[model samples]
Target: MREPADVAVVGTGVVGLAVAVELLHRGLDVTVVGPRTGAHQGQGTRAAGAMLSTFSELEPQHDAVRAGMETAERLAAHQAYPAWLERIEAMGGGTVQAPSGTWVLAPAGRRSCLDPIAAAARAAGHSVEEHDASSIPALRAPASSAGALWLPTESRVDSAALMEALSRAVEQQPRATWISQSATAVSAGTVACTEGETVRAREVVLAAGCGIPALLPECGRPLGVPPILAGRGVSARLAAPGVEVEQVVRTPNAEFACGAHLVPRTDGTLYLGGTNRLTLDADPAQAPSLDEVAVLASDAAALLDPRLGAASLLDTRTGLRPYTLDHLPLIGRTGDPSVLVATATYRCGVLLAPRLAQLVADEITAPGSLDAHPYRALRPMPAPRIDDVLADGAAQGLLEHLLQGGGHLPPAQQDEFAAFTALALRALLDEGSQAGAAVRRLWERAPVIEAVPALFALARRLEGVR
Candidate 1:
């Protein structure tokens, strides 16, 4: 048994720590519960490039309203990050080293992909500049390179350093108590731990990322927490002595992944990231596959510099990014008034942490302040139309295939391949009926073969509704 506090925040990831720190700043007593070690393997914060990207993440969205709101939220968070980092540092979290600016590269024949990103950035009042691929220093542009865009506003932080700082900040706060154990169950005001310890508080926040689904049943009823799937990504750290870039170098979001990106860490090592495989459940013990690492290396070589392929592979990390069906975060109060859910941030957890923390604190201090907030945890998010799903699926699938060496084919063959992919997807949808439709929808959002279990669950749910 532990003394009741003002709040009990489950999970110690970026979001959980951010929320706890924010609440503590508001004069609240907090009990932070979560394991401090290997528990975070495959979790987003541990393996994230932590790009504070507002514009680079923008893509063409069929739902204008959703797109607009998402952009607004990301922009708000991007603006607040610097100040927020300053505050954390002041609390003894240590300084977070984040290099300024990012180069968004467009490979040959993919100029169309960069157009929408640049347009969205301009509409949001950010400056974007186009430059010849070869003009960028330290880049060994492939012969098929198209061009590049300079986004001065985008940047990336060393995720491991940031996480250490957050932990230090929370540990320094006298009003916060850190429990080094996994939370087995959570309810309105009580959280049961793995060791049979129960901590009670007036309010509870579930920020456990992919762990949310498991604890939801213990809440005694539905919390309106949306279905969360894991977007598993594999990233590698390379010690390429002669290969270096001053800033973040990445491609525009491609297929269901964030695309290949390189982030320079303070220690002279480079972070190479760009693979997304969605799954129904995340395995913390899962290791990165050789094939995945090979793709990352080849993509880095093709898109950024050839030296990356020869770079010494220092280590590889896996992160399971939690996402919803519609690919938006589920924040704010859930069906349980006393419990708020703030997971499913997908690819932008680190970028959006500070803003989301503020949002969570505001809701706690003043309920109904975010009643009209678009990402309310239990809000209705119907699936996109079947036709829209098929269209986007084919387009993204083709892009993914191309990025994975399919682009080597002749232009005419590439077009034929695109048509063939679209036809195959249509056939899959038609033959599998409702189940096929559900899988196709999930595939477009996260085109990974490992997503079949989640796809089936979605199919059954939709079937029940019908």
Candidate 2:
């Protein structure tokens, strides 16, 4: 066995690096292993928007997986920015400029979608201000709508500066060793490097972003992994020609645009994003999809001032965000206590890093300080139904619906239908559960009338399957 360190953290994204800094702050010997430092290129924090607004993201749509998100724990991460940013700057690291305010907009006279969002913010003690359309910024054409709800507390930080600062902090630590090598495998406390070296420690922290499931099999735990789905988000940086907005301006659920989001950087570049597609098996080395870029640009032009059409383009970037079937982030220890996990925060990874690092660090060094129920690592992951793929945290709800007669066909054959449904669905999940895209693909390949009876017969004839 190689020499064991106090702690070995895998992955060098913001979360992993933050954990290293926290552990070192507490006087624990630490080693951070991942590509950016030496391994290869673990892309995550670098491509993040680093928005620190849980209040802005308080859509009750995901209440099933991540309940109590508005509670103190989630806010702790976003709240740590003020103090943490100061600490980073004190170490000679550059600053992350967090502009004040964010505008959540809706189409003309269609503010109904925002009612629940506004109500949730008030219930969580956050402030929301409504603005009249006449006084709002003159966004050129289609994108310009009546007015918006001003989320004064929801702010965004420059992610590039934050990551540079974090990298500096991690490097400055005397007890933290920076290892640059792709971790090919991990078992117990030992991580097998692609460079033919095995590094071991007493405990390990896996913060490998979307690469979590890949390393889980190597960890010697056979309790199955949450088949993580990767959503590729693309962003374009541009200079708004005539736009006169000081705060981050965003739209709620723009179908034409991915997330229908736009942000004006401190450096005068309007950051327009983001196109999300399921990149389950796609290679990240490929360039950002041009189709996605075109749609985003088109959407921005329509949603904002027509002058956006004349804006200067700076650069385009892409990052694969790790998403789970339930949409809830995994943050606690895994089935094997030796290997703790923190991945699947999705778009909120950058915002949640600081507080999540503190919580995970405390869990390792000082256990029981934070409740693990909300972030339990090894709970049974629910499969997305064919109709509602990617449970969106209503796994239990879907199960209860099936059991409570939500969509049973005929009463005469209800029991057989339910049993057959249960058996066939279980078989489809044999290899591993998948996200919605696969089911959609299957439907496209075969006619529903023919495919239905075919799959049913196949399920019924399977040997030794109860």
Which residue pairs clash in candidate 1? none
> Residue 391 in candidate 2 has what lDDT?
26
Q: Estimate, for each residue in 131-207, the C-alpha lDDT of model 1 and write its tens digit.
A: 88887767777777788889888878888888999999998999999889999988889999998889999999999
Give the Cα lDDT of each candidate: 0.80, 0.64
Tell me how far candidate 2 lies from the true structure as C-alpha RMSD in angstroms.
8.9
Q: Which regions in candidate 1 have their CA more than 4 angstroms from the true location?
A: 61-64, 218-221, 393-396, 410-416, 429-466
> Candidate 2 on 142-208: residue-level lDDT in tens?
4336566877777788777777788888788777777778787777888888888778888888888
Which residues of candidate 2, in runs, are more than 4 Å off?
37-42, 60-67, 70-72, 91-94, 108-110, 141-146, 218-224, 254-258, 368-371, 388-466
For all predicted structures, in order, the TM-scores are 0.90, 0.78
Report the Cα lDDT for candidate 2: 0.64
For all candidates, the clash counts are 0, 11
Number of the top lDDT candidate: 1
CA lDDT, candidate 2, residue 314: 86
RMSD of 1: 4.6
